[model samples]
Target: MELKKKLFPFFSTVGILIVVLGLYAFKSDSATTERYVAQTRWENLKVLPQNISKDSLDYLMKNYALSLGVKCTHCHVPSKTDPTKLDFASDEKIEKEIARGMVKMTNDLNALYFQPHFPEPKPKQVHVVNCVMCHRGAVNPEKYLSQMGEMYKTYDPNRDNRKEMFLEQQKKQ
Candidate 1:
């Protein structure tokens, strides 16, 4: 009766303190975890500029991942001994090779077309095509614009006859 009433408030306060401390511990541990540590260290970057800082590399990599609606592991293979550790230099994943081709294609497309017609000078330019132009934050774009997918499926980039075909089509029109 009296004991229950007296201890109830103390027990409740102690329980809440325990829970708060546990939550704080979890938050702190996660904040200092290996993923955060890895983000601070960079090595063996091949495609991007070798002089690029870790922060810039991380930002660009994150943007690419978000553009494609994928996680780091989508193009990276994790270390067998430490799952949190990624082999950034490894080309084990085919998606990584595809991404490189996409980057080159985007650069070529921008250089050949949009850059020339710029109303303003570049290093200032507009209407540049990036992954987001078609991807819209997806690996495979959503169905509303699936014609883009069909076009890509039927088109052969390596055939190198795109310019000829475009001119032929224009002549018909």
Candidate 2:
């Protein structure tokens, strides 16, 4: 009885130490596992940031498709092995290159014109133009000329002075 009583405190401390060490080991292992699990490494990333979140990248891609009146297949090529599934990493399509160029152009435009220059930035909702502004759900924005007027459709700047013609038309309006 005396031996049990004396060993009780020592045994209790040993058991508690074992449990604490077990918990610390479990926590460390889980943290290490989580670091690898949380990372999503993409294959090819050129224009956009490599570490961009999947949701943000998807949103941006969907916007491009919507703006150009195109589907995922427009920019992404179908997988050779699986015909149904898209291989987004493949730059086989010329459209993808064009899209990259357009993205770069918009980014440049935004930085040059729309981005705030002042140290004390004005609290204004400054509208930044994007693909939608020019494309407007059309694959070719040149089609917009048909809706503008017949003069726009047939007008050749080489022969006719565009500035003079536009001024005259605006004056009549």
Candidate 3:
């Protein structure tokens, strides 16, 4: 009975230790698996981080859609396995390449102009320029000549006169 009492405490401690170790191993394994899964989740990510969370990627994609006034089909092709679904990794559409270039440009601009002055007070009201700055909720932004023509009403450019011709040609309405 005395030995049993002594053994009980030792066995209980060992059992508790084993359970704790098992839980820790499970947690570590799951964490590693999660990281591996995250890395594999994204394919053909030339600009965006491959390990970006689904929610963050979705939010960014939705933002891009709104900014450019386009749907997912504008840049993504239909999946081979599932025609109804988009193949996000596919580069079948030229628009995707264009979009990637635009993303790189925005990132470069932000890094050069806005990001460098961060945490400090911004020099201007607009700290960063994004797709919305140029796209203005349009798939193709209004021509610069048209915008300038509308703004100035009577300013005619004589340099090649292409702006004038573009301005006179339906004025991009």
What lDDT score belongs to each candidate, Candidate 1 first? 0.74, 0.78, 0.79
Question: On residues 112-168, what C-alpha lDDT tens digit does candidate 1 reach at each position?
Answer: 888887665565434379888888788866544645546677744344344456557
lDDT agreement of model 1 with the native:
0.74
- Off by more than 4 A, model 2: 1-37, 117-127, 145-173
Task: Summing lDDT over every window of 10 consecutive residues in candidate 3, give the lowest-scoring window.
Answer: 158-167
The TM-score of predicted model 1 comes to 0.55
Q: Which has the better lDDT: candidate 1, or candidate 2? A: 2
Native RMSD of candidate 1 (Å): 11.5
RMSD to truth, every model: 11.5, 11.9, 9.2
What's the true lDDT of residue 140 in model 3?
65
Residues 1-173, candidate 3, lDDT per residue (tens digit)? 99999899999999999999989876656656666643346789999887888888999899999998899999999999999999999986767877888898888888788776777764433338899888888876655335666678676644333334644664566
Better TM-score candidate (1, 3): 3
Give the CA lDDT, 0 to 100, for residue 148 in model 1. Answer: 53
lDDT of 2 at 10: 100
